[model samples]
Target: MSVSEKATIICSKCSAETDFVAWKSITTDTDPIFKEKVRSGELYQCICPKCGNVTIIEYDTLYSEVDKDLTIYFVTNKDSYEKAMELLKSDEANSEEEQSGVFRVVTTRAEFREKLLIADAGYDDRAIEILKFITATHVKEVQKIKFDAALFDMQNGKYGFRFFETGKAGIFIPMVEDMYNQVVVDFSPKYPTEEKDNLEVNLNWVINIVKGNNNSFI
Candidate 1:
């Protein structure tokens, strides 16, 4: 189910207050247009009617794709993060049925977009994060180029990533299938044995796994 609240937002450029339908929760199955907007990073953009200036806004939203069994909490601050954690916990305790799916809490717009792309592409978020961590580590140690984020990208028939630095253009790195496959094979046994609800999988989870089984992938 999608939930939205109407609010009057003052445009930064013209100071014109525009009515905005802020989506608090989005269910992708019922709202394909919203899903596309969120995926393209344009969900929070508001165009000022008076000045035509585009303003990007950020807020906490719960995005869920029922078909994919994926739910993500896009949080912007510590308070929002805590609120999301509590909501997830409460849902787990009160729900009468269990739905095995991927649950994630992201603090950035880039991460929110990345998670959606990862889920849409049917990639394991864990393996993708592990791949990113490995690639980032390699670049830092060998190439000496520190990137802020490595976002998943698919072009033509290829699976690759676009690495972003603070002020530099994104550098594209083609996915190495062998490395990704090996990571899955190496870590599958240690991961969840049975499907569970709302499993938090991301960079931190991958880092912990790597630290414990450093030899497995390194």
Candidate 2:
């Protein structure tokens, strides 16, 4: 079956209001055990007038058989997306390390858990200090993460770090403590540069600091 309906969705980037027609349908099939499964749902789709974005809004069912509402969109044209994907793949294949002002710091997962414990004990200042130490001390090791950019997690507590390559970046930190305890660090390079020459210098610097030979403050 099919029915026409309308709904509104906010654009993720621009927050512009968008309206689209919704279609509803149903499906039926017989299981091998002779049981029949009946599925009925309303489907949604939207087209953004301002951005010319076309996307599926969702599908809802009375029985709650569907797991989630599905949606999709694009920020750039097809050509741009393809080109960007190509560039990203190339960067990954070549493993070219580009430096964005952002640096990625490495800490043991146990240390991350300890940091959370410190935060829970009301040692917010100490937690922050530890993070600062970890980031600054490991700056050299962070530079070797083989990415275009990286950043430390300063918000909340010391959770993990992020690495950026090609046109994208990833957060590799696990969430600990309450939902808010995970730290988020974002780094964007001022200008793109290669890490070939500086990688060794950074590695040695981080090694020295981790070995407690360097007394520099974070």
Question: Cα RMSD to native, each candidate?
Answer: 2.7, 20.0
TM per prediction: 0.86, 0.21
| Candidate 2 clash pair list | 101-189, 103-150
Tens-place lDDT per residue, model 2, 1-218, is: 22346677887656789876543322112111111211111133455678866565543321111212111111124454455335434647338554232111112222323333333344332223334345433543764444554433334544545445674755444324442232212111211234222221123433443455343433
Clashing pairs in 1: none
List candidate 2 segments past 4 Å from native.
1-46, 49-143, 151-158, 170-215
lDDT of every predicted structure (CA atoms): 0.77, 0.36
Clashes of each: 0, 2
